[model samples]
Target: MKGHYRKRGANTWAIVVELPADPVTGKRRQKWTSIKGTEKDAQVALRRQLHDLDTGKLSHAEKLTVKRYLEQWLDSKARSSISPRTHARYREICEKHISPAIGKIRLDKLRPLDVQRLVDSLPDKGLSRRTVLHVFRVFHNALERAVRLQLLSVNPASAVEPSKPDQADIAVVDSAGAAKLMDEVVGTRLEVPVALALGAGLRRSEILGLRWGDVDFDDGRATIRQTCQLVKVEEPSAATAKKKTPRFELRFLTTKTHRSRRSVTLPPSVVGLLRRSKASQSERRLLLGAGWQDNDLVVERGDGKPVRPDTLTKQFHKVSDRLGLGVTFHGLRHSHASLLLKGGVSMKAISERLGHVSASFTADVYTHLGRGIEEQAAEAFDRVVKHER
Candidate 1:
């Protein structure tokens, strides 16, 4: 009967431990340890918890629902350490889908089919595949945390089929198209960050996060160190539109992957473009006076605030529409990868330059370009054999 566990509720099992409470307040809080399973399973859990207590891993039980725990996870696990944009994404998924369905479920009772049901409801609820998948990831992450905290023994979301949309072809504005885009950028109101996207194939954030110090004009090299994210903060008061400051402020942080923090050599033309851009940014500093917030190098307005990464994308789209061109800003990044592959650069080299986490990832994304280059190589071998014979 020692270390005997009692079924508290649902899938939750616990061992009751009595502790003195405040007699004045008449609040005698029940001290219970969380476990998940039958009596036999509880014995093993009891040993683990006692072992954890001996080793300093056992903590208090919170009868927290999936919804409450998710909020705690986001605030503690995400908002405390991660980028603002990332927190926004986690919060959005929790609100739009996960919170609505299984958020009320106890953390211990979450099942694989429960996760599947969440994904299955998306289409009927008019949510996109991408949104549904994001929600799934959030739910998976929550369950993963529960396992980490020893609240649950398994991750249910891992067992379920993920909602993957019919993927559209990888977009690329080919070499000639890229050149056209760059030329148009030069003539338009688009800034240097915009130019960098088309010319160098830098992502919008990478371009906007670039500091003057990161740019090495003499060596034509640039180092990626940080990303600028729009952190969302609650606005307490209704202020005048003109007087309203940003509810979301830019916070500089590291790249998503370690490889993303890389140094790349820019072409001479791109270097010149950056130099001009730098001078323009300097002029803005003088105009903004005390209003400017400087973080160096990233192409921000004269006021020193970094531009939202998507602002460049929206601008690029507008320009493309004006020029009667059909292209996404991301197409420029794809084009860069294609050009590298076509030039016979090894996937590893291309992966590093593009900040890809793995060479396999590079190979997967640019498979079409690699296939074309491989075909050309085969044709070259055939030509050489016939000529030699």
Candidate 2:
């Protein structure tokens, strides 16, 4: 419905019409085409474009730059459909990886070779295979949307195969190592959070999001219904030239996946630890009196404010370095899973306990831990045959 005519050369005129805003970039979209002759010809062309736009036929005339189209596509289509974190990640990928490479190419003229060249160049730029795969996925998904929108005849990204990432090596601590680490952290602020990660296999975000209400002391269980994490916010355009650092704010979001919202039975040791943590918090609240923020979070700062996930990670790293533990905070969760697997826990049970989408995924991730189980199974089979003989 938005159209206009402007003088071009002596006898030529240009017709311009505003289209839907780019979904990715959140920028305005405009289509411009030239017509030879007088003002009458320009007005006629403008009317036709307006009519086409109104009837959804203007897609045929789209001559958008790849950068422009990606911006528009992400803003209009992807913003509402995806999580804020995922949307931000897609935007980062587009800006950092895709835009610098082939963004100026005409959307209609983009070729598979162009995409392949970009993918081939990523490794030379020092990106890992996993990160390169993520970049490819974002680009591929955007192109798929473009095809659906009739912006492209075919998705060029579909012709370029993304490289598969190598299997990740997981580091886990033994029972003795975990016990020593726990003893070192005794009576420290990290005690409860570390216990949750090592004993209950809770993710860092899940531990931060836990509240007193989520814990059932009588039932000896805890429910993971939400997660808290700090997400980076885009800086204002006016502040960009000042080199202002990006800001991050704590946000409480739904569990990572549908299966992530599950219940975990608490071990008696963890229960006792939680009880002691609660008593310590109660003493602090009494001392602070009216100054206390009372957020009821199981893991929080002294003022009851949410603990920043990054801060927790840094502190854990410092403690691990001092103790020479040689394990990350996530290693605690890996240790918990490894211990459970070694104790003969069923794969399905472990998957559910870890809130995995499927037991197969759990088994795949813990394949190294399952080797001992194979030996145990073989031993049991031998015993059965010997008894029968």
Candidate 3:
């Protein structure tokens, strides 16, 4: 109910606080906390503890280690609130990065320096700056939940400054380059999928997850319902008792965001390409008969199985390398937006077509392409002025 501090060393103090008596036994209770700072800081800490007691938010310190707490968090809070892929990623970050660094430290005793050291040592461990930032964020989120649950008085990660990654260059293709890519993929397995990527602005996952039912040849639109992802799962090998081998399995998950589950109009050329692909698949299905798997994927192998997402990327890389396009498969999506912008499409329309969360986000990603549009606008304005005069 009340608290006070006494100097234990040169700048260290012990804060002792009185607690409500035990219910049945009527025994007195007290909690002690150590502060390693000036007397003023000790006073502030005591006040905070007392306030927490008054508000029924103070909890007894436990001997829980960071590793144990993170495991519990991932199993309970994270599993329920986040997607399975995200939960797995968070657990991987904890195990591969944070746990090895400071997992043995007591949760309540974790300090800002400990967290900073973990972050600072990551680049030396061959982790990218982006990866380092991601690890910090995952650890910080777990600690934040601990604070909300009254498990700790503060989150140590808040005091640490994470390294910022440099801005990544966005690769885009011009009209001529897009034409070259299209021509290179003609009569190849990537033909229809590449057309969908460039013409419909579909993400790679969306393209692979597409089904025949989702496309409307008559309407020239395709509904994005799900995305395909390759997830790593643990499989126990028969030869080993306690050893687990990680294997990847393809999963069809709901679209990344609500806006991502949208319908995009297909360009006429893309529609024609899809029609030809459909007829080709139908012929293969009949030829294989019962031998076909028949998953009904829009872009699949000849045996009617889903194409591996990585294979799609590698194949695209091969074509791009040969053509010297210098653009990635994902860059096809960027090229779609760039072409639309240069063709005088409205930002809102383009955003919706690409299933972006907002037009502002679309603009931010395509800001590099704005210069050409600006020049075109200035020329139009000049023409209008001369005609009016």
Candidate 4:
């Protein structure tokens, strides 16, 4: 039987407890649990807490240190509400970045200045501004969960100023530069694929995910219904090995966003390039029958497997470096959007082609690129107002 609980403070009270006999020590001991509220409330609270201890609900009540609490937060996160890729990123940041920096620190004792010092020290540690921000974001999210669960009274990360990223001028490759760059790829293995990326505003992953069947020459359009992404895995299981391991398959999966999965009209130049690339692939398949991988459309090798997306960046950089273009593979997509904008394409039309959920997003990213049109608009405004003024 338990004794009567006594009020210790406003919204809190304490209960004297007898520790169970220790066989080795051959003695019982006294202990105490400080619970919050009135006598009846404390009774109910202590009973519920004791129940929780027996049922594993409050398993950590006795040993819920900051590190333990952080682990529980991370574990719950991994089990729900996140994609594998996103979860992996969070896990890496927690383990490699945040935990190493402050894992042993008491969560309740963590001051805003302590966090600020970490952010302040990031630049000296060779962390990129973006990476430091990411580390802070991970901790912020974890601590937010802690606060919600009553493990933390408040989010310490929220009180600290977040690290800011340094801004670089938006890079946009213009029309003439795009044409000159396209000319550089005219003779290489990258010709057709690079053309599609530059001309269609297709992401490199989306291009690699494309298939010959996805194109409609009669309709003069191609459906961007899928995107390829790399995922690391251990050795294949028996079931996976039997079916050619679908991760490696050119298995058509849905696009990343519903807005991105759309039918885009192909230009005559790109349509011809696709025709040529397909015909060339067919000829190569005939040459190597059993040796061909044969799962992807925009394949890089004769083996027919889908092209690795990162290789495109490497190749693009190589070409850009060779040509002194000051552009990137991603710059090709920017070039595509820029040319359309410069040619007086409407934001809605460009958004549709680029698969942006909203034209506002497109407008936001290319504000500098869109400024040229604003300049023209201002010139027209001057013409209209100059005589009146």
Worst 10 residues of 3 by lDDT: 20-29
Q: Assess every candidate by TM-score.
A: 0.77, 0.77, 0.79, 0.71
Which RMSD does model 2 reach against the true structure?
5.9
Each candidate: RMSD: 6.8, 5.9, 6.6, 8.4
**Model 2 lDDT, residue 287, Cα:** 95
> Over the stretch 309-355, how does candidate 2's per-residue lDDT look in tens digits?
98999999999989887889988898899889878889999999989
Superposed by TM-score, candidate 3 places the C-alpha of residue 370 at a distance from the truth, in angstroms, of 3.8
Q: Estimate the overall C-alpha local distance difference test score of candidate 1.
A: 0.73
The numbered model that scores best in TM-score is 3
Candidate 2: misplaced stretches above 4 Å? 1-61, 76-78, 81-83, 150-154, 237-245, 379-389
Candidate 2 Cα deviation (angstroms), residue 300 = 1.2
Candidate 1 vs candidate 4, lDDT winner: 1
lDDT of 4 by residue, 1-389 (tens): 24446787787888754333321233554446787667788788777756543443432222345565567677787677444456657777777766677667766566677677777777787989988888888877887776665445566777787657764465656767778777888867788767887899888777878877788999888889777666543356787675533243223445757789898898898898888878888888988899888676764556687777777678888888887888778778878898898788998899989999899989877777788888988898999999889
Residue pairs with backbone overlap in model 3: none
Q: Candidate 4, TM-score vs. the true structure?
A: 0.71
lDDT value, residue 11 of candidate 3: 89
Q: Write the per-residue lDDT of candidate 3 for residues 123-155, one digit (tens) a residue.
A: 999999999999999899989888876667788
